[model samples]
Target: MISKTTIDQVYEAARVEEVIGDFVQLKKSGSNFKGLSPFTDERTPSFMVSPVKQIWKDFSSGKGGNVVAFLMEHEHFTYPEAIRYLAKKYNIEIDEIEQTSEEKEQANEKESMYLVSEYAQKYFEKTLWDTEPGKAIGLTYFKERGFTDETIKKFGLGYSLDEWEAFTQTALNEGYQLEFLEKTGLTIVKEQTAGDTKRFDRFKGRVMFPIHSMSGRVLGFGGRILTNDKKAAKYLNSPENDIYHKSKVLYGIYYAKQAIAKEDNCFLVEGYTDVIQMVQRGVENVVASSGTALTPEQIRLINRLTKNITVLFDGDAAGLRASLRGIDLILEQGMNVKVCTFPEGEDPDSFSKSNTYEDLVLYLEENAKDFIQFKTSLLVKEAANDPIKRADTIRDIVNSISKIPDRIQKEVYIQECAKIMQISEEVLYNTLAQINKKEVNEASKKIRQEQKVFEVVKNDPLVEKVDVQYELERKIIEMLLLYGNQKQKFEDLVLKENEEGELVLEPEIVEAKVYEKVYLDLQEDEIELSNEQFKSIYYKLIESLNEKEDFSVNTFLSGLNQEMVSEVSSILMEEEQYVLHDWERREIYPKEKQLGVAQLVGETILTLRCNLIKNRIRKLQEKTQDQHDDNSEILEEIMNYLQLNKLLNAKLNRVLS
Candidate 1:
């Protein structure tokens, strides 16, 4: 177990923004930092990091927690792992109590997999540096590509011996399980027809590249063959399994996440050597999808760090055509994607090796074209000298433009395309509008179908749902704000069951704030949140209710995690929609949009409805006999709910049909 002293030291030394900024890209949005939601696929920034509170919130996902929580959510680290990660990040050396070998043997499967993969990485690296064949083959291959020893070590480059079952035998002897090794694609196990199973190394006889998750856990491996075998594939990758999903993995994200976040832009490449060469040349904010076509999952992985992506493509016409679809996927996510094509016959690896860093950067800067323009022009040229294909090409570009989720981006691209194609802007706009309309109609139809399947659950026919009581909620809000500022006092009672069967109140009582009052009351009555958003708002409110000062909305907003703030802000602002505008204003009884007073109203209303429904449900549950049929019980509930329905209608100022 980690000591409290160590935890405190780690927390104190760790800067929330600095720690989180390594994994998620953050930009200054007022006092707090905001970036694209790491939890969701988004274009606009919704993830927020607040250094003041030392917490982050994803407004889109409605999840906000402190530094440790962010690690748990983003990296999928366990509690102890998160703490250790923080300790590692801040350079706080952990001095843990040693466990016996027997106790250490009790480690779980996932941790064992990690250990085995890490061991394989070390084994491969050792083979490369420590063995003659590896040095002659794997080491020489990397050096020939201009990769420095430091870069090789940084990327965890290694080599596998040509001998079958070399790694598998060593791992098995070290007490690692073959099942996990096979699952991680580290070992290839095959069953013989007449005898028992045979196991061999999957990456045997190849130079190795370990693909890592963002937190530096070994997810899988990529291997390249050195020997000439006409039938054998040049390079082989680890197959997808529980731990490694190729679509979601990037080649060098472990090294590039910080640089991408700091630079506010990512340099995307096609291959692993390209990433190393580019970063070595001072283009640090770069990663590769490992020579595969970009997936939405892969794009979202980059989306976690930066919104601006500069895709480095080869100058080969075929490679460019093959890779254009991936560029379209980036734009679909609402990210700004720019293309940088290297000189003819040169990839990023060769290009950077041949030119100075400034020249390379300048080459990319001068050549980088917007994905829409680049894609359109490429297809336009391809369709050239073929009139039938030209008409199809325009439609194809329009279809590509239609994939963009943002309205403004779509409009901008359409205009650019119209200029390039010598087509009317109106025609492009009309095409885009038709596509959008069709998409909306299809989306609406899906929602309607989904709703139909669950309509009964959404409505409560047995009882009238209560309207929220705004005034009482206001009182609670006031109490939370004021009482939180002051020390809380609550009536305390002490009871001893051993000597006497009597309960007595303690002599000294403490003050209670609205948060404590509400929280304690809910706990005492066994009340729980029925929805996740309300649950989030409730927790954040509870968190802030104790702060001693005048409430500042911006500070409150900034303190909450990124995703929840957007939602809470939107909800709080949405509640003021009933406000009388200047033109429509004749008499305004209650002032609107003044501040969080709207949020307070909305929260109060929601709280009242939830509580009222819960109470009614509870009462109905108690009265309903087990012998009674569902139809009769529901009828009885409706009869018993008339007064509550009248009260709800009166408060909401609307009748329920």
Candidate 2:
């Protein structure tokens, strides 16, 4: 187990905005940060991070928590893994015991696969540096490709041995399971006709490139064969498994995330070496598609960092035209894409390797053209002097423009395209309208078909009915969380029988901590929160507030479990989402919750009392109707509750009827 000291140190050092900003593109909204929800598919940003509170909330999926909870949810990390990740990111020394064999055996299958993959990465690196075949072949190959030793090691580039079953046997000897090795595609296991198992390294005799998740966990590997064998494929990737999906993973994202966020643009390349070469040349905000077709998931990964992408291409690329279609996917994501090409016969790998860093940066800046301009220029060459082909090209560009989600951006691109092709804006607009109409018709058809299978339910009255008690309880908790440590003067309402034998409420002035006032009011009435979660949090919050002279929401949250942390964060951040819209700038001023803390606290408590009294009155009337006997006592009790409720409502300025 990790030591308490280390965990507390991580909590203190890790900033919510800084950590979450790595995964989501956050923009400053008031004092907090807001971004698109990573937990859900959303166009509008519903995820919020409060640096002050050290907590985050996703209004889209209703998930909220502190830093650790965000990691666990977004990265699917176990508690210990999340803590360790934070520790590593913040450069804190972890104090913990190593897992024993028995403890390692207790890990789940996906974790086991991760362990095996990580172990394989280390084993390969060791072999590449320490062994004869690794140095003579693997090291020689990378060095020939212009990679320095530091660059190779920084990317964890390694070499797999040539001998069949060499890695498999060594892994088994080290007590690593064959099951996980095979599952992660490191070892290939097969059954022969003699009923014996044959095992071999899947990436035997290949130079290794370990693939990592956005959080930098080893998920899989991409191996390149050095030998010129006609029967063998040039490059092989790890097969689709539980943890690794090539379509969803972008090479070098773990390293490029920071630079991409800093530069506000990502450099997209075509191969692993291309990314390595560029980063080695001091261009950090770059990633590769790993030679696959660009995917929406891959685009979204970049989308989380920035809204701009500059795609690099070889001057003589055979697949240049084929690759142009993928740029449409980027445009569809509402990202501004620019295409850049190198000199003939040179790719990002060779170009970055040959040119000085300044020259390379200059070339990219000078050559990068907007997707519309690049597409039009490239396609215009193929359609030269052919009126029919020119019209088709115009429609193609319009189709690409239609993929953009922003109408203003689409209009801007269309005008640019019209200027380039020397075509009238009206014709392009008409073509765009036709394309949009077709798309909407197809979407409506799909929705209609889905509606047939799924019955629609509407107008459920209970769905709309406000749960006054629950809201009051929630409001009480919100007040306690926000103003619990604050000292304020309050007018306490004391119910009593007056000289005329009528129930009346008299205001008694009192000054105390907000938490103290809430606690005393609830204690005096002997009222308990009906919601179990709120009740537990209520007591824990009060205890924490009473104990700490300098209470912190984040520090207090660190002591609670994930569930309670989520609940408290959601309560605290619900109003923060509204604050993100800057309503004051729109000339709509909202009532600030902090300004009337004392009055809000009193009103919330009084509302709770009123709700409970109404519930008691309801139960008493039921009893009077059921018994039909001497319900005089119950009736008198009900009358007294009604009078008290009336007095409380009157004090609250609420209509009794």
Candidate 3:
């Protein structure tokens, strides 16, 4: 278990904005930062981060949380892993009792696998430098490709022995399980037709590349075979598991994220060596698709860091045509894409390495062209003198334009395309409009079908029979969260004597705080809030009123988890948005002394809950009504309220005090 002091330090040190900024490109908007939604495909930004509140809310997905919560959500780190990441980033030292061998045995399987993977990364790195075969096979391959020793070590390259089961046997002897090895795709198990099972290594005779998550946890591996085995595939990759999703991952992104953010443009290449060589040549903001077609998920991954991407392809026309489809996907994401090609026979790797960083930089700068122009010049030549082919090419460009989600951008591109093609803008506009109409019609038809089914299914009488009182009570609980801490009191009955020297009907004087009154009123009626969230809020308000201090929303809502933060922040913030404006704010309207309704309500509801909670606690001492109790100060206050109520009721009933 982590010490409480360490946990508190972790939470305090991990600023929400700073942590999330490492991934998302955020722009200031009022008191919050807004950016495109990382979890969805949207042109407009719906992701928000509030530094004052130390929370984030993705309006599109309704996900929100503090820094730790984001790491858990975005990178899928567990709580401890998230904490450890923050500690590392912030340079905080973590001192914890190490788990013994027995405790290690007791660890969960997932954790055990993580530990094994981490250990293997170290082992592979150690072997690369300390063993002859690793240095000969892996280091030689990397160096021959212009990789520095530092790059090889940084990427954790290694070589597996040619002997079958070499790594598997070592792992099993070290207390790691064969099942885990097979499950992780590090070892392969095959059965002979009429004999026993045969165990072999999956990455045998291949150089290894350990794939890592953003914070550098070894998630999986990619290996390239060296032997001429016609039956076996040359390149082997880790199977998809809990931690590895190929479509969502970019090779070398973990190391290149900072450089990408700094440069504000990612240099996208098609293979691993292309990335390593370019970066090794001082082009730091580079990543590879590892020879796969671009995916929206991968594009979103890049989108998280920057909105600009420049793709590097072989200058050969064949390579450009092959990669043209991927460029359309990039443009559709609202990213700025420029296509740059090398001299006919060269790719990004060879070209970048052959020249100095400055020369390569200048070369790419001169060669890069906007997508439409690049596409047109490259294709117009091929379709020359063929009117039908040229028309088909124009349609292809229009279709790519239609993929853009932004209206303004699409219009600009359409005008640009028309100008470049010497065609009428109206014709292109009509073509785009028709395509858009078809897509919208198909979408609307699907929505209507879904709506029709939903309407038919939602005719249940029980759905309409939900209690309104429960909803009102829930809202009251929310109101208490707003005004529970404000200092306000309600009028209660007070005792007085009549002119005849006897108790008479009169209004009683007693102070009841707003929060205490609300809490006690609900408690007195035994009205359990129907919603679990409201119930929790209610109990917390009572606890705070009993203590008589400022309520801590942070403490009250701790461990409610990420799924609940958005709902809770909405409920807590919606009633305050009105007061957040300029004219009604304190800084703007202090002379008028006008308070926005939300500010007023936020203040009032908090005190109301506080007072209600006070009343509920005072009622606990009903046994000591109108009587003095020296046991405690709270007991004395309870006696006073009881005595005051009794005297007023006696006066109303014409009874003696």
Candidate 4:
């Protein structure tokens, strides 16, 4: 468990924008920051970070919470893991007590696998530097590849020993379970006919490359075999497990994320060494697909950092034509992609190793070509003297352009393609239209088929009715959260006999804290929030506001559970989402909620009272109609309730029918 003092230090020192900015590129919008939603595939910026409140909300996914909750949601970190990550990021020393055996065993399965993988990485690193065979084989291979000691250690490069059971036996001896070892694919286990189990190292005699998530947690490993065993594959990766999915994991993302955001571009390559060599040569913003085909999940990981991707390719790569298709995926995500190839005999690794840093940087800048230009040039060469092939190539280029979401960008690309191919713009536009129409038709067909499987209900009356009480209660909570600490003048309504002998209501103006006025009004009327979550949060919020002299939303949020934290953040940030659009620029001014806090509060209370009285009147009328007895008293009570409801509605400027 982390000490309370250390947790407090982390919360105080850590800035929400700074921490989230490492993963999601945030831009300044008013007092808050806005970015693409990491939780959803959104082109518009719906994810908001309020530095003032120290909270973030993703309107697309309806997920909102404090800094700790964001980590837990985005990175899938446990509560303790998130706190520790913050502590490490902010350079706060953690004071932690060792867990007991029972507590250690209580960790979930995924966490256990993570711990085992983490231990295996350390073990391999220790073997690389501390043992003889590791230095002789693995260390020599890396050094020969032109990697420095600092570079190797920075990426956590290591090597597994040649013996079959070297890693397996060591992990078992250290009290790590064999089950987790097998699960993480570190140890391969076999059961014998004699009822005994034989376990061997999975990456035996291979150099290790640890693959990490965006937050630098070791999810799995990529190992390269050194021996010339024709039967064995040259490279192997950890099998699919709960913690690691190869399609979603990118090599060197943990190291390259900051640079990618800073440089505003990502250099994509084909292998682990390509990323390392480029980063080592001062080109730090690079990631690898690990020689696999590109996936939307992988592209989205880069999308979070930047919208520009420059793919680096070897000049003599055998699968160049096949890999060109992957560039279409990038374009589909509405990202700008460019392709750069090295000399005939070199790849990014060899080229970076051979050239000086300045030369490498200059060569990339000069040689990089836009996707349309590169594709047209390459395919035009192949389609030389063949009209049909050239026509197909033109269609292919147009197809790629059709995937872009922005209409203006698509049109610009179409014009460019027309110029490069010596074709008319009308032809390319027609081709794009056909492709788009086909896609829309296919999508409609899919939706129709899905509709056939289930009954479609239209305009359900129950779905259309507004929950008036719920909205008013939500408004009350929102007001309390935003203006509870501020002092405001309010009109207290007093019902008494006016100048006449009849009863009438009078208003007496008074000054008090917003929270105090709200609390007293609710207590006097005996109104309790109908929603359980709102009720629980309402009392806690009042208690917190009353106890603290200096109120902080971030500090107040720290004391609530996850559910309460989400509710409070949503209530507080509801108005902020609209404020980001800068609507006043269009000469349309929306009323600011802060300008009339007192009026808003009083009106909301009056509305609540009116709603409650109307409900009472409704029930009394229903009882009088159902019962044959007790007619006079029920009728009188209903008349009195109607009068009170009318008075409250009048104060709210609401017409009662």
**Candidates' TM-scores?**
0.74, 0.96, 0.79, 0.96
lDDT of 2 at 624: 82
Best-to-worst TM-score order: 4, 2, 3, 1
Please write out the lDDT profile of model 4 over residues 1-657, one tens digit for every residue: 788788888888889999999899999898999998988887888999999889998888989999998998888888889999999998899877765545646778888888888889999999999999999999999999999999999999999999999999998777778888999999999999999989899999999999999999999999999999999889999999999999998999999999999999999999999999999999999999998999999999999899999999898957777988889999988899999999998999999999999999999999999999999998999899899999999999999998899999999999999999999999898899899999999999999988875544444444556788888989988898889999998988899887767677798999999889999999999999998888998898799889987878888777788888898888878887886677888887999889999999999998888888888888888898899986999999988888888777777777878
lDDT of 3 by residue, 533-641 (tens): 6676567667765685755555444445555555566565442333334355456544321233233433333333333444565576664565565547767666655
lDDT of each: 0.74, 0.91, 0.73, 0.90
Q: For model 2, what is the alpha-carbon lDDT of residue 289?
A: 92
For 308-412, candidate 1 gives per-residue lDDT tens digits of 899888878787777878877887887888987777899999999888999988888899988877887788888988988877888878988898788888888
For model 4, which pairs clash? none
- Taking all chains together, the TM-score of candidate 4 against the true structure is 0.96
Q: For every model in order, what is the number of clashing pairs? A: 16, 0, 30, 0
Report the Cα lDDT for residue 203, model 1: 88
Off by over 4 Å in 1: 29-31, 44-48, 96-105, 460-485, 488-657
> What is candidate 2's local distance difference test score?
0.91
Residue 507 error for model 3, in Å? Answer: 11
Which regions of candidate 2 deviate over 4 angstroms?
443-455, 461-464
Tell me the TM-score of model 2: 0.96
